[model samples]
Target: MSFINKMLPNVSLIWPDVWQATLETLYMTIVSAIIAGILGLALGVWLVVTDQNGITPHPVTYNILDKLVNIFRSIPFVILLTVIYPLTKAIVGTSIGNTAALVPLVVGTIPFYARQVQTALVQVDPGVIEAAQAMGASNVDIIFRVYLREGLPDLIRVSVLTLISLIGLTAMAGAVGAGGLGNLAVSIGYQRYQSDVTIVAMLIILVMVFLVQGIGDWLTRRTTHV
Candidate 1:
C-alpha cells in the first residue's frame, strides 16, 4: 500500500475506477477482436474466393467486397464512431457506453483485419492450392485445410497488429464516453490536470500492448512452418 501510494499517488486515490476502467478496456478489446476476427476472416475468404483467379471465381462479387473494404478502411475510427452512432444506438440501445462502443470498434476493425487476412491467405502457394484441387478437395477443404492452415503464422502476426491497433482504438473510444482508460485519462486525468493519473493509464495501456505483441510473436514463431 505504501509502495503503491508512492508509485502511483494520484492513481491510488482512484484505484477502484482505474481497475474498473481497465476491465472495461479489456472487455471491449476481447469482444471486439473476436467478432471482428470472425467476420473479417469470412469477408477476406469471400474476397479471395471470388477473385478472378480464385477456385470459385466471381469477379463481380470480388469487386463489390473489395470496394466495400476499401471504403470502410478509408474512414477514420473517431469519425466512424460518430458516423455510426445511430447504428450503435440501435444495436446496443445506447451510443455512449462500453457495449455501445463495441459496435464501432468491430466495424472499424473488420475492414483492416479483413485485408490482413486476405494478404496472409494470398501468400499460400498457388501450386499447393492447385494440388489440393487436383485431389478433389472442395473449396471448404482448400480454405480451411490449405489456405488457413498454411497462413496461420502470418495470420497470427497480422492479428497481433490488428489487436494492438484495436487497443489504441479502445482508448479513442474511451475518449468519447465509452468507459475505459482513455476516458479515465481524458475525462478526469488530463482535464483535471492529474498528470499522475494520466501517466498511470498510459503505462497500463502500453503494458497491455506490449504483452499482446509478445504473445503474438510467440504464437507466430510456434506456428511458422517455413
Candidate 2:
C-alpha cells in the first residue's frame, strides 16, 4: 500500500481515471478488431479471388473494390476523424466520444488489415491450390479449408499489428474528445503539467501493447502446427 501510494500521484483522483481509460481503450480496440477482422478477411479473399488468374476472376468487380480499398487506405487517419464525422454521427448518434471513436477506428483498420490479408493470401503456395483443385475441392473449400488455414499464422501476426496501430490511432482519436488513456494523459496530464499522470498513462499503454504482442506471438506459434 505504502509503495504503491508513493508511486502513484493523487491516488484517489488518478486511480479511477486510469482504470476507466484502460477500459475504454480495450473496449474500442477489441470491438473494432472483431469487426475489422471479419470484414477485412472477407474483402481480402475477394481481392485474391477476383484477380485475373484467380479461381473466380471478375475484372470489373476486382478493379472497383481494389480502387476503393486503395482510397480508404490512403486517407490519413487524423483527417479521417473529421472527414467522416457526419457519417460517424449518423452511425453512432454522436462523433466525439469513445463509442463514436470506433467508427473511424473500424473503418481505418478494415482497409489496412484487408491489404495485409491480401498479401498473406497471395503468398500461399500456388502448388497447394493446384493440389486442392486436382482433388476436386470446390472454391469455397479451397478458400476456407486451405488458404485460410495455411495463412492462419500470418493472419495472426497482421491482426496484432493492426491492433497495435489501432491503439495509436485511438490516441489520435483522443484529440477529438474521445476519452481513453490518451485523452486522460493529454487533456489532464500534459495540459496541466502533471508529469506523473503522463508517466503512469504511458506505462499503462506500454504494458497493454506488450501484453497484446505476447498473446499474438503465442497464438501464432500454436497455429503453426509444424
Candidate 3:
C-alpha cells in the first residue's frame, strides 16, 4: 500500500473520483455502442441490399445512404461534438454530462460501424448468395442465414474495432464536459499537474481496450468454422 502510494502519490486523494469517472466512461461507451451497433447494422445492410449489384438494386437509395455515411464518417469527432450540440441539448435536455455525451457518441460511431458492416457483408461470397437465391431463398432468408451468419466473424472483429474507438471518443468527450477518465486526466490530472492521475487514467483505458480486443478475438475464432 505504502509502496503503491509512493508511486502514484496523488491517486489516493481522488480515488473515488477516478472510480466514478470510470463508471461514467463505461456507461457512455456501452450505451452508445449498443444503439449505434443496431442502427449501423440496419443502415449497413440497407447499403448492401440496395446497391447497384445488390439483391434489390436501387441506385438512388444506395447513393443517398452512401453519401450520408461518408459525410458523417469524415467529420472529426471533436468537431462533431460541437456540430451536434443543439441536437444533443434538445434530446437529452442538457449537453454537458455523461448522458448527454451519448448523442454525439452514437451519431459519430454509426457511420463508422456501418461502413465496417458493409465491408464485412460485401466480403460474403457472391457465389454463395447466388446459390441461396437459386435454392428459392427469400431475400430476408439470404440476409439472415447467409450474409449475417457467414460474415459473423468479420462483424465481430469490426465491432471490437468500433468499441475500442468509442472508448477513445469517450475520453475526448471528457475534455469538453462528459465526466469520465478523460475529464479526470485532462481537467484534474494534466491541468493540475497530477502526473500520476493522468498515468492511472491512461493505464485503465489501455486495460479496457485490451480486454475488448481479447474478447473479440476469442468470439471471432469461435464463430469462424472455415
Q: List the residue pairs that clash in candidate 3.
A: none
Q: lDDT by residue for model 1 over 14-100, one digit each (tens)? A: 999999999999999999999999999999888888888788999888998999999999999999999999999899899989999
Q: What residue runs in model 1 are displaced by over 4 Å at the alpha carbon?
A: none
Question: Arrange candidates by lDDT, highest first: which order?
Answer: 3, 1, 2
TM-scores for all predictions: 0.97, 0.95, 0.99
Report every candidate's CA lDDT.
Answer: 0.94, 0.88, 0.96
Better of 1 and 2 by TM-score: 1
Backbone N/Cα/C clashes per model: 0, 0, 0
Runs with alpha carbons beyond 4 Å of true place in candidate 3: none
Rank order by TM-score, top first? 3, 1, 2
The residue-by-residue lDDT of candidate 2 on 1-226, one tens digit each, is 7777777655346787789988998888888889988999899999989988778999999999999999999999988998999999999999988999999999999999999998888878888899999999999999998889988998889889988898888877875699998898888888888877888878888888999999999999999878
Instruction: Show the colliding residue pairs in model 2.
Output: none
lDDT of 3 by residue, 28-47 (tens): 99999989999999999999
RMSD of 1: 1.0
Best by TM-score: 3
Error of 3 at 48 (Å): 0.6
